[model samples]
Target: MINIFKIAARNLLRYKRRTLLTSLLITVGVVMVILFSGLSGSFKQMMIGLITDATLAQMQIHKKGYVSSIDTSPLNLNLGPKAYGKVRDMLEKNPLVESYSPRIKLGAMLSNYKETTNIRLNAIKPDSEIKVCPALPDRITFRDRESGQGLINPGEIIIPDKLAKGLKIKQGDTVVLVAHNKEGSVNGLNFTVAGVIESVAGPQGKEGYIHIKDARDLLRIDKPEVTEVAIRTRDFNRIDMLYAEINSALAEYKNPKGNPMFEIHTWEALSPFYNIARMIDLMAMSMKIIMIAIVLISILNVMMMSVYERIREIGTIAAIGTAPGKIMGLFLAEGFSLGLISTLFANAIGVGAIYILNIHKITFSFGRTENLLLSPSVNFNELIWVSAIVLLVSIFATIQPAYKASKMEPVDALRHV
Candidate 1:
């Protein structure tokens, strides 16, 4: 076996140019696959982080009819006080739930002298808001001008930075908010702009936030029923478990219409952009597969031609009593050796490139949002999986050609030359 390997190594070295070209092709393919996989992984991480950390929690509980009727006024499928207590209690007891926050959302139109934009006014508790959305606390300063009170209070609102600019409104300015009450009556209120917030997910600078009490008073709901429950978990990957627990708790609550009126939705379900991200990932993977197939075919063709060219040499060795199995081993070893070397070189090059790009903050932006840039990073587990996949693909690509070379008849091969 050792002698056969040495002979195979020598043969490959004798054809250094051909061997180098084949190796380069394989190396290029492997490098591309690794680089693309790294990029895709990074994009997925950024999207998940943005959704989970900045916008949506892992799971949400909403009044059953809220989602379908979101276009309508602020009518709450109101989880009554009893239901709220029950659900909040259950969430606190659930080991999987890290924290949960109550939110009331109202659809209202924000109007200044020049422009009007429809906005979803999320009513949030300042303390609980920080736990659910880590990005919110640092985003803006809600304050009262006369009393110098900070943190959003009743009749104060925070508008997204982009929306604020478009409306030509600034802090301390007044804006008109029109929304429907639970009784389906339209009501208008004037609010002082407490601050301006920056958000990547909200309507291109069109959304606004206010205190829960303010939203409740504006909508004329005396009891202030919450429209949604945002839940944070110790591990977002356990979102299914958290959803199940919350749904079970809500099962006992019935709405004003005497219908079970609470629904649980995961972040992926609530955010349409998550679906788009998934589609982009699938497309990228498919493209990588196609590229690998093309490279594999090239490698196979090169090996086959190399084998035919060396037919006389192979036959001479076989005629000198080299067993068919040993002859087969030689060709297989050559293919394996080539694949191994190429994979090593490709991984080194790919990793180096990714490292450099990440360190330099190479970015691609979308629209005016800075967070839309691609982030490139790989965790240990992903690296292991990607390396294993590359090795398996390289080995698989060598099989058919190796088998063909292994089965050639010495007499027939020699006669052909």
Candidate 2:
């Protein structure tokens, strides 16, 4: 084994130019794959944070038909007083339920003195909203509307930063909101802009949020009419089970016609962006496959050429009683050495590049929000996984070529130039 390895090392060194070129190709392909994987992984982490922590919770409950069509016409499964009371009671009783809040959503037109723009309005309970949507605490600023005071009432409104900029409205500007109430009545309410919010969702940054009570009064919803329910769970991974249980609970409740009216949905069901994240992951895998193919081709071509060039030398060694397995081991050792060197170089380059990018605070602009594109930063576990994959691909790529070289007839090889 030692002799075979020594011969292989000597042969590689003998053809310095070809060996270096092959190693360089492998190194380049490995580095590119690692870099792209790191970037893709970072983006995925960022998206997860934006969706799970910043925006959507583990599960959401909406009117039976609201998930399919978000029409301006009154919500079909409007959770009235009885339904709200019952659902809330059921959720509180469940051990999986960490917390939940009622949300009234509407599409409305907001008008300043000079301009009007469409907006999504969310009516939320102040304390409950803060728990479910933690980003709200950092995004909104409070200021009193009267006497230029720096404090605002709980009933005051908070508009998105994008809307505030587009409408030329500021902290004290009064905006008029026009929307259909729960009873299909058209109503208008003037609200003082107490603060501005920034959100990952582009439309969210143009939407306005107000206290649920204020919204109920403005929209003239005399009875309970929450459009949706936002739910948080003790464990996000157990969301499917929780959703099933909630559905079962809701099934126990019957409408006047004796049928279930409520539908349960997980955060993944409600958010289309999560599907986009999965697609991105698929794309990253495709890229890695392509990179491996390129590296494999380069390695195979180099090994084949090396075998052809060393035909006489291989035949001489075989004729002197070197075992066939030993001959194959020589080529495999060469391939392994090349892969090991390239892997090390690639990992170093990839880690250094990621560190520099993170240090510089490189960020990508996403819709109306600009945030750090990488989350969990550069993870060591990912690096180790990628490195292992690269090594396995390298070994597999050389198997056929090495086997072919080992099977060559000594007499024929010795006769060749």
Candidate 3:
């Protein structure tokens, strides 16, 4: 083994350019995986925080089939007072249920009389919303008074700053919201602009927040129907635990219609941006595959050339009684050395690149919100995993070429011109 490594080292030194070029293919591949993984992870976390912390809680309970058509914000699919009461009791009984809030989501037209635009209306209880999203009240920049807060009363609406400027409306202004209820009847509500705020994450542009009672009145829902219940737990990391507990408890329970009452969703399921996150992951995987292909092709070509060039050398060694296994090990060692050398240096560069990017606080916008920092993040385990994969690929790529060199006839190779 020692002799094989020495021979491999000497051979690599003999063809410095080929060795470096071959190693570079592996290096480039490792660097891409490292940097892309870090950036993708950071983006995923940011999107999750924006959704779970800013808007939807960690989990939500919605009527079955609600998620498939969540875009329409269906009024006909809702939790009636009886079902709502039962679900609330179930949540209250569970120890992991840190807090929960009910909300009514609707698509409506908000008009300042001069300018009119469509808006997503989120009807929430100010008190409960604060518990789930503490930053909700703080996001309100403009209010009727210095001490004003979130949806203090019905007939009061909160609009985003972008919406406020676009419609030329501000705090204390009056607006009309026109919406259609489940009964297919159009209804209108007049509201006083209580505040203008900014969204923390998920979707951009104009949205409105109103008191739940007002939503009920405007939609003519007298029986206390709720579109969904947003749920938060003690720890996000342990959300799966709570989710399992809730599911187990509710497994045997059914609605009066003998159907599944509700479906549980993590923030990922509720947010469309989660698909974007998954796509980013797929892109990283594709990049890694491309890197592998580059390394595989480059190493295979170099190793094959080495076999052809050293045909006489192989015959001379075999005639001197060196084992065929030893000959194959020599070429494999060269490939392994190339992978090991490139991976170490490439990973080092990748780590440095991520650190610098995070240090500079690079950022870009998604929809309407601003100042989304592009912070790259990585971990030690992933670094080691990438290295191991590269090394294994190096060995696999050289196998056929090394075996061919080992099988060369001593007489035939020695007679080559």
Query: How many pairs of residues collide in each model?
Result: 0, 1, 0
**lDDT top scorer:** 3
Pairs of residues clashing in candidate 1 = none
RMSD of each: 3.5, 3.8, 3.7
Candidate 1 residue lDDT tens string, 87-182: 788888888888888988778888885678887778888667668877654556554444435457788888888778777888989899988876
For candidate 2, what is the lDDT? 0.74
TM-score of 1: 0.86
lDDT of 2 at 47: 62
Per-candidate local distance difference test: 0.73, 0.74, 0.83
The lowest-lDDT stretch of 10 consecutive residues in candidate 3 is 143-152
* Model 2 agreement with the true structure over 253-324: per-residue lDDT tens digits: 776788677888776776666787789778878877886886688778878887878889889988898888
- Using alpha carbons, what is the TM-score of model 2? 0.85
Between candidates 1 and 3, the one scoring higher on TM-score is 1
Candidate 3 wrongly placed segments (more than 4 Å): 1-7, 65-76, 93-98, 107-118, 130-156, 172-194, 199-206, 213-224, 233-251, 409-417
